[model samples]
Target: MNKLILSAAALALMAGAATADTVRMGTEGAYPPYNFIDDDGEVAGFEREVGDELCARAELTCEWVTNEWDTIIPNLVSGNYDTIIAGMSITDERDEVIDFTQNYYPPTASAYATLTEGADMMGGVIAAQTSTIQAGYVAETGATLVEFATLDDTIAAVKNGEVDGVFADKDALVPFVEEQGFMFAGDDVPLGGGIGLGVRESDTELKDKFNAAIDSMKADGSLNALLVKYFGDETAQY
Candidate 1:
C-alpha cells in the first residue's frame, strides 16, 4: 500500500467482494525473500508460500498477480485483484484507503546500507523505493531523498555513488551487506505496525477469512517457521 489516497468508504463503493472462483492475490513480485519472480518465471518467495497455505486454510482458490509496488493499492481499488499479499506494512495512512488483515509478518526494522562504514546516514543523500515508508522517513528527517521505482535501483544508487546510502528493510539489506560488501551505516529504525494482507473495506468476508488463516498459522507455529525459513534464525518471530 504505497501513497494511495482514496478513503475506505469511497473504495467500498468502488470495489466488489471476491465473487470469482479464483481469487487473485496481488504482489510486487520484485522484492526478494518477501515476494519475487523466480527462475521459472513464477512468483516464488515467502509471501507466495504463505499465501498458498492461507488460501488452502481458508478454502479459497487463489492465484498470484504481479503489479508495480507504487500502484498496487490503487489497482486493487479498481478491481484488478481481490487481495494484496505483498509485504505491505500496516499504517494509518494506508488504512484510510484499504483494510488490512491482522499482521502475518512481525514488525521489523529499517536500516541504512552504505558503501563505506560510518557514512552520514541522516545528513547525506539517501535512496529508498518510491512511496515507501523509508522514502517518507528520509524526506521528513532532513536527508535529500532520492526515490526509485524498484528496490534494485536504490541499491544500485548506493553502488554508483549516486547517494550516500540506501534505507530499506534490514532483512532485505542483509544479503547486500554480507555478499556485496556494503556496510550498515546506522542503527535500525523500527517503523509501521507489521506486515498484513490488504483488501478493500467492502471485502470484510475476505479479510476475516485471511485473518482466521493467519491466526491458525500463528497458533500452530507454522508462521514462525516460514519466517525463519526465509529470513533466517535471527529474524523476529511470533
Candidate 2:
C-alpha cells in the first residue's frame, strides 16, 4: 500500500509540473523606455515590468527575450516566442496576421526634423522602417518614404538632411530627440491608435488572460504608475 501511494503522489507532482503556465514574451530591447536592456544585462523597461505583472496576475511565469522589431511577428508565428510585449501598435494590417490583446498603450505618431521650420513634411520625404505603421502613414500621405533597417539609421537620415522628417512612436522618439537635442517640428501628432500585446492565432486562451490582466492593471492604476516611472508624470498621459 505504501509503494502504491508513493507512485500516485509522484504522478500527481509530475502532472502539476507539466501544467505550470509559462509565457515566453518577446520585445525589441533597443526601444528605450518601452523595452530595453539595463547596465547589468537585465531586461528592464515599462514593458518588462508590465509583462511581469501580467504573468503574476495570470498565475504564469514570464520569460523575456530580445528580438529585432521587424522579425518579432515572424518569430511569434513560428513558435519561437509565445507572445510579443514590445511597443507594437495595433492596426488593421497587422490584425490580418496575428491576434492582439486589448490595447495596453495608446499609439501616437510624431515627426522629428533637423530644420524645425515650415514645410508640411508629413507629405514630403519621411524616413521609417519598412512595413511599419510609419511606413503605412508615408504611403497614405504620399510622402517620399525612405525605409531603413533600424531606428538609429532612420534618425541619422533625418539629422543629415537625407529626409525632411522621421515618423515613429511618439513615446519612443520624443525622449530621444530631447536628450540628443534634435529638433521636433510639430506638436504630438495623434495617430489615434493603441498598442497591443501580440499572440499567435492559436493561443487565444493566453491572449484572453493577458487582456484580463491589462484591464485589472488599468483599474488599479498600476499601468499609469509604470508609465510615470519611465516617461515622467506629465508625459505618461498615454
lDDT of candidate 1 at residue 195, scale 0 to 100: 96
**Residue pairs whose backbone atoms clash in candidate 2:** none
User: For residues 54-131, could you state the per-residue lDDT of candidate 2 as single tens digits?
Assistant: 999988899888888878899999988898988888877788899999988765555545444664676678888766
lDDT of 1 by residue, 99-147 (tens): 9999999999999999977788889999999988888889998789999
Given candidate 2, what's the lDDT at residue 42?
84
Candidate 2 has a TM-score of 0.85
What overall lDDT goes with each candidate model? Answer: 0.92, 0.80
Top TM-score model: 1
lDDT comparing candidate 2 with the true structure = 0.80
Give per-candidate clash totals: 0, 0
